[model samples]
Target chain A: MHVSFQVQAGDFSNAGKVSSTVKGILKQLNLGPAHIKRIIVALYEAEVNVVAHSYGGTITCEVEPESVDIMVCDTGPGIPDLDLAMTEGWSTATPEVREMGFGAGMGLANIRKNTDRLAIDTGEDKPTRIHMCFDLADGATHA
Target chain B: MTLRDVVQIVDGTVLCGDDNLGREVHLGFASDLMSDVLTLLADDILLITGLSNNQAIRTAEMSDILQILFVRNKRPTKTMLDLAKEHGITIITTPYSMFRSSGLLFSKGLQPVY
Candidate 1:
């Protein structure tokens, strides 16, 4: 099964909607609870990242019998330093974003912690893309 | 501890999911940051937070946290409560600060989700 969602930047009210929808589908598929939780966590962080930092984005998920692939692509002021952005305490979120209880700089770290595999592509002048895959066979155990 | 016990311990008001007051939560995590809340690994945990926004409810929903206690008399908006109700998440509000709420729950045997 495949699903896609459009995410609007600064849409904090609608943040997590994509993750919620994907989670429902995962539940209907009878995926393990642990696996579903990890997917939701990763997808949610990515979704929020778009809402908090991007101009807009799209989230696409392809669910297979053995694994799930997720791609979040956003147009925005892309990260100039991927390594710094990956750090746990580095963020460029606005004060309003921080007041919303996000921008603690744990978004990418949380995504990294929950996915089996992750790939990020971004530059100061390019759109950001995060690709994540989770192997269903392993459930909570990431390879 | 059962959510009923949580309500009394922290002097909280049940804004939604009153029927679920008897539900038991073994662990509790307190934070205003939803990102920190997402990093928790335990199931059946209760979230105690000062954030009174929709994201708090959304965070609990995504993390599979069934109960949320808003501290410092912070009340959630009607929309936020509605979302919690839709997700079957119990929402409660307390006059106690976040620290006191967590401390009270901890004193009553609710373990921290460390």
Candidate 2:
């Protein structure tokens, strides 16, 4: 089964809703706990980026018995410094996002750590698209 | 230590999963930051937090945390409690602040996952 969702920017109130839904689906599909975990972490970080940076965008997950393909697309002010943005402590989150217990700049790293494969496309005003692959063979590739 | 030990140490009110108090929690992650919780790695851990929301349950779900201890009397919404129930995660609330709760747990030998 496949599921797609729109992730709105600054919608911190419901940021994790999409990822949570995806997780439930994976569980019902009988995916291994390891695979489900990677999918959860990757999709969650991507969702956070959507709300923290983009003006809103979409998160589409193509779920199959073999693997789950997740793509997060955002159309907001693009990252000017990809290198800096990837740093652990780098953050552009608002005070409110921080107050809600987020924005420590660990999203991308967490995604990379959890996922089996990762792809990125970005530029100034150019929507950032994050493509992540999680194989059903126990996504146990954590740091 | 056991979930029961954590409850007693923090003076927490059990919200759900009373039957599983015998469950054990080998580690603890004390952060309201969902991001940190997501990235943290541990097994049989009890998550202690100040953030009372559905996301807290979501984090617990992803991390395989069996229990959630909300410090400072942060009452989770009905929706949050229901979500935790679905995940089989025990929820507890306490008047103790985050620091005090965590300190007590740590003193009792529940170290951070990191």
Candidate 3:
């Protein structure tokens, strides 16, 4: 199955709706609980990043019998430094974003932790796109 | 510990999921940062946080966290409560600070998810 969602910039109120919907679908598919949890966490962080940072974005998910693929793309002032952005405690979020209990610089780290394969396409003044895949096979080891 | 015990230990009031007070939570994770909460890998975690917002409930849903204990008397908004209810996540509000609430729960045998 395939699905897509539009993410609005600064729309914190509805940030996780995409992840929630995907979760429901995955549950209905009878995916393992741990597999569903990892997908939700990665997609949620990516969704929140779009809401909290980008101008707006789109999240697309392709669920297969053996794996799930997620792509989050956003119009942005993209990351100036990929390595720095990947650092656990480094963030460029404004004070107002901090007040919302996000912008802790853990989003990407969490995404990395949860996904089986990941890639990013981004640059300053360019759109940011994050691609993540999760293995759905039973008994697969997770980080 | 059962959510009912957590409520009494922290002088809390149930804002939602009253019917689920019997659910047992084995670990307590205290943080105001939802990102930190999302990084947790354990199961049956009771999120103890002071940050009250839609994201808190959303975080719980994504993390598969079944319960949240809001400390420092931070009240959850109607949107948050509605979301919590939809997710079947129990919500509790406490007058104590995060430190106090964690300490109290720890003293009462709520293990930490380190």
- Report clash pairs, candidate 1: none
Question: What TM-score would chain A of each candidate receive against the reference chain A?
Answer: 0.94, 0.91, 0.94
Task: Give the DockQ of candidate 2.
Answer: 0.64
Clashes of 1: 0
Worst 10 residues of 3 chain A by lDDT: A134-143
Q: Each model's TM-score? A: 0.97, 0.89, 0.96
The local distance difference test score of each candidate is 0.92, 0.82, 0.91
B1-114 per-residue lDDT for model 1 (tens digits)? 799999999999999999999898899999999999999888789999999998999899999999999999888899999999999999999999988898889999999876
Ordering by lDDT: 1, 3, 2
In candidate 2, which residue ranges exceed 4 Å CA deviation? A137-143
Candidate 1 interface RMSD after superposing interface residues: 0.6
Best by DockQ: 1
lDDT per residue, candidate 3, A1-143, as tens digits?
Answer: 88998999988788889899999988887788899888999999999899999999999988888899999999997988989999999999988778878898999999999999999999999999999999877743232
